[model samples]
Target: MAETRIRIGIHQEVRHPYITHNLVGVTFSSLQVIHSPPTKMAETRIRIGILGCANIARKVSRAMLLSPNTTISAIGSRSLEKAIAFASENHFPESTKKYGSYEAVLDDPDVDAVYVPLPTSLHLRWAVLAAEKKKHVLLEKPVALDVGELDRILEACESSGVQFMDATMWMHHPRTAKMKEVLSDPHRFGQLKSVHSTFSYVGEGDFLQNDIRVNPSLDSLGVLGDAGWYSIRAILWAYDYELPKTVTAIGDPEYNESGVILSCGASLNWKENGKVATFYCSFYTNLTMDITVLGTKGSLRVHDFVIPFNENVGPFYAVANSRWKELSLGCEPEPSEFKITTVLPQEALMVQEFGRLVQGINGGEAKPEKKWPTISRKTQAVIDAVVASIKNGFKPVEVVY
Candidate 1:
């Protein structure tokens, strides 16, 4: 059977109906098409180009190759030699094109999408440009420096009719969904009361001095945007993506001489019913990513909410409606430990999910899923509120949205 390629914009060239082959470089079971036409068996893959050779790009590049319907068709860097080295060091296919400039990747008709792991400061410029070029975008978070900047990127994607997603790995983990199921159970968890989250890891001396995250001009939001984003997003996810009524800085944020945040904590309150959440993100501590949530009848706890200790399996604890024992020495039932397993890493899952959406858009079977970007905006809005609170002498700042 001759391959029929349908080009959507200058990016996508999708095969109709059946999906054969792994689509990824690996040989695996064929993926069944979600919208199979009454035609023949055919496989579809999304050809992704990568912008920049940032360190995080290495992991995402691997993920793109692992995703069943995604491939790294090209990669670009300011230096042609650097791009060539990065592609080789990351083990990209020999056929993968290496360009000296990001624009070349965007201009490549074979590239259906682009994963941008550039510094946070550069997100707005490149993301908007990628969208305008009709390439689906997988951007690194915090998606923008502020909500206003983020809106521009979103608008560009909307105008060009392309998919947009921020890279937040934990959100795609199976363990996240499992934990949510328990948290959402009315009888088990009841109404949410409070949540506390933290994401912290001590950076090496050199890292603190030289990392982009600690650089004011490159990453002004610093730890708040880097490590804090995960904790904040986790809090928002627990609240069903609802914005807090007010966001207040709990203490003075630690900052370097450059005025970039190094450590910070914030409290989010839904003042009406007195629900509250607190989170801390730091670059001066041991590795930790924790989320603890309490409700009227139950609670949830995850030790590694950002990155599981084990890559293959993740465990979370949940206790629903536990009653005190006669002596009050021990609870009636211990919190049930649920361990979710995954064959692939969470980052791979994220890439796979993004590829699926791109595929649907390519086939005209579906529109871009708004949920991802919506939550991203909410997360950024909350961050903005936190910054405002920090600037206003740690006073509570009302969250507009």
Candidate 2:
């Protein structure tokens, strides 16, 4: 394992309209087949040990059960009975093991990776432990409460040669790429100028009292941490991770009883690129979540951020700017028309890709893929800035990542 450092070209100049185009070009084009050294290729199938029986683990476990190359061979929780129950219900193999604590999972010789869906404050601790044991990690969303924790996780993973990834499945889906393509067309959406994104749902009785999501002492571990991270990342993906120099955020009238923002609105100013992004995330709103990118000629409407619902099941739709306002009106049969595709569930895609990486696909330098940590860190930077803005009465804040 070696120390890893990222160098950002702050002096580089890029226009707003070309940001998304350049990202796709650079990422997809430069994607070389990374292969691990011959010694590491022999170990395949990538055995995974889950840290907890958290609710989100349901989707992840199901995806693992369906994936042919990955296996959920073990599970751990504070309660051994709970761990055994989860393993039994999920049909773990007869040889599958159960543990009463998370550390045991990291110590398991057969476990090559650990999935951490723990509270925000616990991510760094467990992630570091998993890495120290030379185990790869697939952590849940937000990665950490703030950028400092993100840095520590990256440092630990880099120093330990573990495959560390912040679970953001949206980018793995074909629909996301297609959305970018449809939005790129000048005829459909001329020069882009503005964009808006949101991810929200009712979370009234779901959170536990002691859950880190509601525990302010843990810091920045609430709605913004829970769902705002995604909305912010979508913006960064659209803008090519070119962080805004100034940001203003407000969280009120939509926060939970605990004062954690249930709904938040943020505005960003990236002057060099002449781009602006406005995002809102909440847990108090009606069942509504979507992202719309506004361009000079047209607009792209992403119907659902988490998962597509119906015939039009992707995250975005491109509509001519001329017709966008008309559709927004009471006009019958909205003007925007387009095709739809499903973003293959991210959990499955991530597992499949990681399995290949472990099989030594890309350089297998024992380093986590560049994109995973880059975006994770950028998202945390935005989250920290937004939280600061709210605490300062929506004062404009600069995000440096």
Q: After superposition, how far is residue 153 of candidate 1 from its true place, in Å?
A: 0.2
lDDT of 1 by residue, 1-401 (tens): 12223322322322111112221122223222132232321246788899999999988898887766677889999999999999999999777999999999999988889999888889999999999999999999989999999999999999999999999999987778767877887777889999999999999879988999989778899999999899999999999998899999988788988999999999999986779999999999889999999999788899998888987777887776678898898875666666676767889889978887888788777899999989999999999999999999999999975
lDDT of each: 0.85, 0.70
Identify the runs in model 2 with alpha carbons over 4 angstroms from their true place: 1-43, 206-212, 217-220, 251-258, 310-315, 321-344, 361-367
TM-scores of all predicted structures: 0.89, 0.81
lDDT of 1 at 158: 91
Worst 10 contiguous positions by lDDT, candidate 2: 14-23
Residue 227, candidate 2: C-alpha displacement in angstroms: 1.3
Point out the worst 10-residue segment of candidate 1 by lDDT.
15-24
lDDT value, candidate 2, whole model: 0.70
What TM-score would you give candidate 2 relative to the actual structure? 0.81
The top-ranked prediction according to TM-score is: 1
C-alpha RMSD in Å of predicted model 2 compared with the true structure: 8.7
